[model samples]
Target: MTAAAVETKIPASAEWMRPGRVAVLLFAVLSLVAFLLPDGVLPAWTRQLPAEFRIGLDTWISAALKWLVEDATFGLFTFKDLTRGFAQLLNVPLDIATSILSTGLLDGRGSSAIQLAPPLPWIAVVGVVAALGYRFGGSKLALLAGGAFLYLAVFGQWASAMLTLSSIVVAAPLGIAVGLATGVAGYRVPLLRRIITPILDLMQTVPTFAYLIPILFLFGFGPVAAMIATMIYAAPPMVRVTMAALEGVPREIVEYGTMAGTTPRQMITKVMLPAARPQLLVGVNQVIMLSLNMVIIASMIGAGGLGFDVLTSLRRLDIGRGLEAGLAIVVLAIALDRLSQAYAAGARKRDAEGGLKPFLFGLAAFVAVTYLLALFVPPIATYPEALQISTAPFWTDAVKWINVNFFNVFDAVKTFILLNLLLPVKRFMMAQPWPLVAAMVGYAGWRLGGARLAALVVGLALFPVVTGQWDYTMMTVYLCGISVVVAALIGIPIGIYGGLSPRAWRVIEPAIDTLQTLPSFVYLIPAVMLFRVGDFTAMLAIVLYAVAPSVRYAAHGIRNVPTMLMEAGTSMGCTQKQSLRHIQVPVALPTILLGINQTVMLALSMLVITALVGTRDLGQQVYMALTKADTGKGLVAGLCVAAIAIIADRLIGAAAQKLAAQRSGAVDAT
Candidate 1:
């Protein structure tokens, strides 16, 4: 060992006992001081603050907002009326779809004039997918593609799944078409993109429930309205992705296309779109997952099928039915995702002769069986009662057991959370006075990024406070904070362990995917049963939903760190722990932070669904507004949630950018 190495190595130490010691000490002191203070300490402290510190003067503000909306809409713009109007408009498409199934020239009538449409011979759908898959990838992918369709059919959900699939089938293409056009528009006319970008940002961050109210109003409850709403919600990402992919296409390739005397349309279709195919497929995958996520929610306004059944079960507290329906959704989502992924993955491996013979044979066989069954077996469309499956009994028994045995303990935990944890956090944020908190957040942004990012942070953070939702807004923040913290506690270590080996990555990836795609509501049932309807349940739900991003990005970022650097650390006699702590972690921090940003967004999005656990937060406001048909109220609440999302996004994103730049600079210097 060298003398320099001996000098450089310090005595055994803990990171927590150094600079963080002061913070820990201060926390302890503050907690002690809080404990020593009288029960009226908060009230006295609040009294010392300026009057403007107060939030949400509800009655006056409500009246003023009502008047503003009335005046803005020329006295015919009440939210309820608007929702009613939307519902009426949406009814047309629902009526058409329903009438087609219920009354058309098709099947044997079942009571109401409506008769079920003969299921599309499964062979056709499968053949198209197989061909599409083969076109996208190759033989293995085509088989995977065929299998996904076969699973849907065998599972007896072929009919309803197809209905959901049809809407998405329609919405996905429409989204792609719109996104591609918009991407081109944005790329060509920067001004148009500039105008569209913020709306896109707002659309992505805003609670879907907020949009649902207005959509239901304009279109009325039905599949078409649901389709419209799904498109609106899911389209932005594709547009952004397509634009990015096109912009990133090599300048040389494009010039080659131009030099080849290709027309603009031909160049884009043959050159740009095909070249940008990979990213666009990613956008499509996003669209599929997002659309499926909304399947249950979309049913609220008349989009029917499994999602409707899921929602119905939720309302009835039939856990078996909810689980069955929710699992069905999960299975369908997995199937579509796998098929899409296989297609995309296979795109680079195009086959010579296209394996046309085998594919055609498979298609022929599938089609023959599907139509034959449709003709001979009426039961193919609807499964028999004996085949119906459920998980509701387990949930109900669990719910009852918890309620009976743990009610007092749960009550105490809830009270402690509300009175001690949540209340104190809320009061502290409120006590700071809005300007100070805004300034602090802005300053942090400036330190991490610069003036532009700081300005963005301030604007987003202040929006909700100015809108008079600061109190409930903070409640949402508190819940998110708890979830994010808990999730990080679990996720970061797992991510670290997973990043160490390919085997771990294989095990972790599917878990992450499952967590990522499982509908937000699915978590609500177990959370309510175990935790039993309080802040804790909501927090638990958020944590489970939010953990995936952290685990995914962390593992990805760490594993991707240059092996040469690890070798250098090894050459330096650094232990594995030291190499990871001092080398890998610093390099991976930016990506990990990116994961945290995603986790926060996911947690915020969970606000609407988690309200089943009884929160007094902004989501509850949105929920109440929905039931009361108060569009203005819902919009305001939705905006508050968006404000929280935007602020977190900006601050964390800026910090990550700064960290990446710092790491880059350090690398250059090395």
Candidate 2:
């Protein structure tokens, strides 16, 4: 036979040697070896990880943080002194805001106390908020804003709620200002954006709990540290929004600005910024929302207000009061969300001629009159105690009644989930060999993207093992994975329904909006009250907290499926189910994948919070570290959580893009 004939008959090279085939073979072999081997038979080196590999990362990080707090110096000042001084600086605006909103300007206490001025009267605050809402939006917004504030005053949340509002007033502006400057710089300089993008990603992906420890070390425990943390957490999204909005400016506008002979500075400030103002306002709204969320977490660190109220109540087992405070937070969030949305929509974009002056004058007059009246009318300054109502007893009784009546039912449901779903998954995850899991993840990365992504994924997956946190990592992965899967299962179908029918969307949208607006901390309240404290409760809280993104994205993806494509399916004589199955689902699959990716990230983030309910995960490690002020443990574990998130985000994103490309190619071929 000729050489070519011989080669062909020999089949060239072994098919199993191909990278994709080899990857699967390695994955299966390792998994089998891991599962079949008796616990001790795999060798401690593989399961326990060597001490050298651990590298004592937590110890090193702790030492570094300790030095920064106690020993490090800059010029004449110790690091702590500098941090304290900055905290003091922050306190000025915070004090002023608190004074204006909640605490009257008073000196000393008891007999020696002298009132400098009263805090804004409850009526004045409500009136001003209503007027501003009307000015920015319309009468409907005015009612919403005014009613929310009135509810706070009437429901006896006036003081604590105001304290929370004050923190937001301080933190939100700081976030916006700093975020704006950073964003502008990033947009102007590509090099800076490269440097900044990763930092922003880290800021956002790291658990909110991780931020508290560093601030605690530097600034000492107080509202200042909390505000600082909130500002840092909330700023990243604004920076992203700023860069995106600036990038989206019209090319024609840019040329026009240049042709008009504007200087670079003027072009940015006068031309580009104005054109991007509407979008920038949206960034402002996002900063507000994030600040509110962070403020709740920050409350644990000494930030007083509604968050503190809830925390204190829960600690004392005052479930009713805690729930009340949590609801107050919800009302505040909804009111602020609606008001900010209207503001960002730029309802005043085309202000009527000569209307602005009269409106402002009238608003000022209304506020002034209310303030003056408060001097004489005590109830105007403070919510009338007689009119105030306490639903705490009712809520407490309701929970009691439900627990007494439905304990078996709730227990049965919880038991079924744990026995059938959560426990089995947890056992499987805990038993998996680290090496096998890493290989499987890497193989997924390779299939989705390439060698680079695979290596990155494998490295990330192995990090917890090397850091001596494998058990905790497994717990976290088990809980977060199960929670995300459940959330996706629940949210995606609802989202599809909403996307398909406008009437369903109208009903579903408000419910999800309410769910999304409530701070993550609030979800824990109900979960704990019902299920008490356990992994089951944590899972419930996580599912509730993370479900919004999945619903939102799935609905968006379905709604945006091209009309022409559906029409094409119909023209081709397809039934509704057939068209949906073949055309719509395929087209929407990438977008739905994105939603799952988002759900995964949110679930991971919430999993860290779930540590509160007592699942022994990385979140618990972080929380324990926080209580001990063990910066190293908290940060390392937090980063492990982040590593998992980044891995999930990147791998899923690659898969989405791969699916999208395949669909596009198929369409082009057709």
Candidate 3:
């Protein structure tokens, strides 16, 4: 070798002493020594920070909120009065939606009021929905949407489902409007996006329960609070999607608009927005789904509907009732989710004069006739109760049957997982000195993304320790970690099967779609019925709620593998398993890491919901705060959860980037 080449290469022994590697190694060693040493051997601050050193962010937040509610003013009105007035104004849309979907319009009289119209006949609602589905996605989608509404009518859940729909109609549009406007603003001013992104992250990551505590105090107990929460919860995703969509618009399109002599305003409205319309629809879909999700969780705070029914049933341990309510939610979500997704997809291939338009109009005309007929026949307005069907008894019996016959199997599985995997992990995490965990995480961040990431991660990790919340934080980590591991084990294989086989993908596609659309709360029902209330049940809920992304991302990664690469592997005489292991797996590793990152995020978000199942973690802390109306406790605990998710997401994302860079480097070298 030449002298230059000899000088460039480092010895193996020296490689171990590279700065990045050495820093982490030193951290590990120092942490171990500090942890194992006598209690007083090291400074007292090594174990826990003094109370005086704590930031007291929670206390400061509470004080600020208090001042806002009591002392702050807008003109002649106090802040509370202004908010309540705005809330009352918000009621107009909600009242209109409620009147149209749930209750018939009523007219004049104290004792003898007449119905101007019966709430749009269930048949009408189903018909209109099916028409929309057909207009966008053809026959199969029509059947799906129509069938779902039909089930709502026949299963005796029309009123509850209608109430739920009412809130969604009001909140979804408002969320879309605000998100779109904000996104547009951000696009126009790059600095706005930089400012908004972190705030959006905090808003999206904070527990849904945390939102309620403040809304509860601000708006008092009513659907208005719920409506506000839904809008807030749903808007962040729309903003993100909108910003991305706008940025993704082809540069050529903008130049075309400019050549046409469009002004800035005209360019945005007629050119940019129009070009971005298809992608904007994707954001709309996300907004609607997230709105529905928040509305359901908001049910706990007086946004009464099917969610209320489900919540009540769970509280009563009425498995049969809960199942029906949960299924209704699932179908409702599926209908809305599928319609929006189809609408967004169909935008690209839109044909204004298509034959399907006629079919849609025909369906709409039939729906109008049903409303006309309902005037004369009240039974047509509402399905007859005697004829309505419910499979509650069957569901109850099924649960009982399972418990009697397979109790031992469930007990053994639960015991094995809890004792061997979950409990031990929790113990190990809690036993780690706070300094050691922080140092370890800092080292990881440094290795993955360097000094800035290391500083960020250390600051976030130490917050819980300083705040005296280490035990609960560890509890959350243990549960989420195990759930992610289990989900990966199950979902990754299924994903691989789907990826490698087009036939398998055909089946897996719809199944995962259904799973993804179902609300988080719905997962809790089956888990509760099977495991009862405990950390194990919480784990199940988190796993079930989080597993879909892993399956989806993994399959996408596998399917997107370059055809030429696969052919090369085959040409080289590689076996199917060998090709997957050596070629496809490495190529897909980054995307798979992204999937795991999503799984971790989803797991953390579910922590608050799992608290309802009796897990003692940061989630439980927020839940307790909600009950007592303690904003400080709730917000602080919520921040901790967000911090955990942000840290994990950033670390995993950085690692994925590192892997991709390494993969690219190797390819370039070859």
Error of model 2, residue 120, in angstroms: 0.3
Off by over 4 Å in 2: 1-33, 108-113, 351-354, 666-670
lDDT of 2 by residue, 557-638 (tens): 8888767666656666767776656666667778888999988888887877788788899999998888888899999999
RMSD of 1: 5.6
Candidate 1 to truth, TM: 0.82
- Give the per-residue lDDT digits (tens) of candidate 1, residues 1-670: 3322421332222321354466556655654555455656555422233346534444454565555444435365665566556556644554454433323233433465444445445556667677666666567767877666666566555666666776676666766677778887787778998998888888988888887876655556677778878888788888899879989999999999999999987888899988888888888888877888888778877677778877777677677667666776777787678777766666656443367677678767776676568667655434454654445577678778878998898778878877877667655544444554566677667766679878988887776665567668767887888789889889988998888878988999899888887878888876666566777778888989999999988898898876656666677787878777777777788888899899999999998888877988889888888787677678788988888888888878876776777666545543
Which RMSD values do the candidates have, in order?
5.6, 5.9, 4.3
Please write out the lDDT profile of model 3 over residues 1-670, one tens digit for every residue: 3322222221221232366776767776875565466657766665567889877877887888888888999788999998888889998898789778987776754468677766888878988998888888999999999999999989988999999999999999999999999998898889999999999989988888987988987887878889999999999988987889888989999999999999988988899998899889989999988887775689988899988988888787787888788788888988999999998888767655567667767876897899899889878888889989998889888988998899899989999988988876776665567777887888788877889999999999998877867778888888989999999998888898899999999999889877776677878877888788899999998988889889988898898866656666676676788677766777777788899999998899899989999999999999999998889889999989988988998888987887777555534433
Return the lDDT, model 2, position 520.
78
lDDT of candidates 1 onward, in order = 0.72, 0.85, 0.84
lDDT of 1 at 334: 78
TM-score of each: 0.82, 0.94, 0.92
Residue 166 miss distance in model 1 (angstroms): 2.8
Off by over 4 Å in 3: 1-47, 106-117, 348-351, 354-368, 667-670
Clashing pairs in 2: none
Identify the leading candidate in terms of TM-score.
2
How many clashing residue pairs are found in candidate 1? 19
Order of candidates by lDDT, top first? 2, 3, 1
Candidate 3 local distance difference test against the native: 0.84
Question: Candidate 1 regions off by >4 Å?
Answer: 1-111, 114-117, 121-159, 261-267, 351-369, 379-427
